[model samples]
Target: MSTYFAILTQVGEAKLANAIALGQTLKLKKMGVGDGNGALPIPDRLQKALVHEVRRADLNQLAIDPANASQIIVEQVLPEDVGGWWLREIGIYDEAGDLCAVANCPPSYKPLMVEGSGRTQVVRVVLIVASTAAIELKIDPSVVLATRQYADDKAAGAVMAHEAKANPHPQYLSKIDGEAKIAAAIAALVDSSPETLNTLAELAEALGRDPHFATTIADALALKAPLDSPTFTGTPNAPTIPHGDNSARVVNARALAEATQGRAGVQGLSGANHGASPANKFTVSALAVTMRNPATGQAITKYATGALTADVAVVGANGRDQAAVIAGTASVHLHFIFNPATGVTALLWSASADAPTLPAGFSFFAYATTIRYQGANVI
Candidate 1:
């Protein structure tokens, strides 16, 4: 029914027809039908003989060309049985039951021929068995079939077996077994030799305690000294006190004092005179005094003599007085004093019989220069 099969059938039929024509032509020439010069004339006898020869030539050509022979067999003898399923082989037979031709069927040929001959000549057809791979056949429920239900069923069994071989169940240790292992480990730690045990006891005493039982041997071996309990040998040397660069290096008080000879002593000033010198330490200048009115008891101006040439005037008051001579000689001694309470300076007559009186709250200031003599100086 495919177009490709139809085209192949057409090509086989055309080749068969061409072969039959060629065979008939050769047969006619051999029978002297178409040969030049004294060939058989086209009469009824020649025509009948030519037709018989052509039929015989076609049969002979069919044997020579299997494609033609198969075509003829399919068309004339097996026309009713030439389609449906694929044909493997085809056998053409004469009416006498002798095999005339055998042809391997083309892939496009269908198996539709009946086996034995009836009225027509026989053509045996061998059909290719239909494959159930492409066909879904219904199975009866009563029939039992053996097949893998799940794809991994067989593979899963093998995988489980391999896993069992690779990892068997572990034998677990009991609590008593674990305790026995720990006891054996502890027993291994205690030294059997008496000297070693004595040394261990001394070490324990030196540490002030026995070593703690540790889970690991390394932990047991790692002994640490107790805090604040280490015994140091010999006395530790005292730290040296660092002295500043400018500090004295003498270690004792007497050494320091000896090192510092001629230094100034404490609590007193050096290179100073404590008392007045033998020289006259006073000078003469203008002299003025303050007087008071005896009747009113109020202050009045009192004047005194100045040095050698002038008379002194009373300061902040109005009066003047000449020099005072004692028994024919002028008195030259003058005494000056300052009163901070009244803010005043007073010039006093050293030999005067009458003392100058001053008003309450009055002050004075004297201006003088230092007097130098050949034998001494006066300030």
Candidate 2:
């Protein structure tokens, strides 16, 4: 992630700074806010700032899944030589691309050892001294955690995602949220023998979630050794490529037919007789779209032409004009080759003038069929 800055009001700076210090005290306590969740290892120096400059930093590339990494930055406004109360927590708005409130940010403080001797000891405060810390906030924690939990529904599938990022698994692991996720991490590692797997399972069960995740790992063991073992170099099956569920397709087809029925020119292509190609449908998990439930997740698909369909559409004024002046009932007949994904049925169509005739002596003849034409090295 990259980093940038914005300004804070004087009063706001003071309030935020005090909050930072208070946050440190909380960290020192076992039972504090979020179990000391928001605390950062603050340095001394930039703790007291009359005004603070916030910076935006991207951490997407960090070892921790960028999504799992916490957002924070710290800077000191007060010089180490002169210190009293330290500026720590800072809340800012319309900054860092519209951040509203953040904690343990820049403009905070920590202590430093100025000097020490066998006979004497000297200590000074190290505060957030820079004009800005190295990072900034992205969204609200509620949003972040909610999204994570939502993704966790597909327990093993979601946790093994980094390993199986190419294609995620289905939503079978909804039982694997929270500690179950932690267990998934532990289980996915190499050397996860039955003992280790059982240990993780016991931990997960203790946490109140189901113990099936360990079994999933055990399944992997049968197919291949533990994930990280040198002997186990292979692909992870995840982000499962959702195949066209014919059953679901049929359900959707029925809905489509219902929607098109009793409507003008909206005849929906359907079952055996209508001769519409059986469509391929790839259904994405509802949570894959976002880490949070407040927003929905959507899947995009790319398809190629299939062997069943042969004709393509030639869109223009005239479909049949002998002497190269193409003119037909539909006035057009386009052709193309297709090798579509088994999951989808791409059909080409030749558009017709609903009126049946055109001023240029144009007549519509046939509708064209188009299937996906080619495969691209798609995402």
The best candidate by TM-score is: 2
Residue 151 miss distance in model 2 (angstroms): 47
Stretches off by above 4 angstroms in model 2 are 1-17, 20-22, 26-379
- Give each model a TM-score: 0.12, 0.14
Candidate 1 local accuracy as lDDT?
0.30
For each candidate, what is the lDDT?
A: 0.30, 0.29
- Cα-based lDDT at residue 276, candidate 1: 46
lDDT of 2 by residue, 106-204 (tens): 333333334321111111111231112322323333321222333465576656765766535546456547468777786676345565445656667
Give one digit per residue, the lDDT tens place, for model 1 in 131-249.
11211112233432222322365588788897887434435767798799888876776555355454666657656663653444456544544456654456534333233223544
Consecutive 10-residue window with the lowest summed lDDT within model 1: 26-35
How far out, in Å, is residue 171 in model 1?
A: 9.6
Residue-pair clashes per prediction, in order, are 4, 77
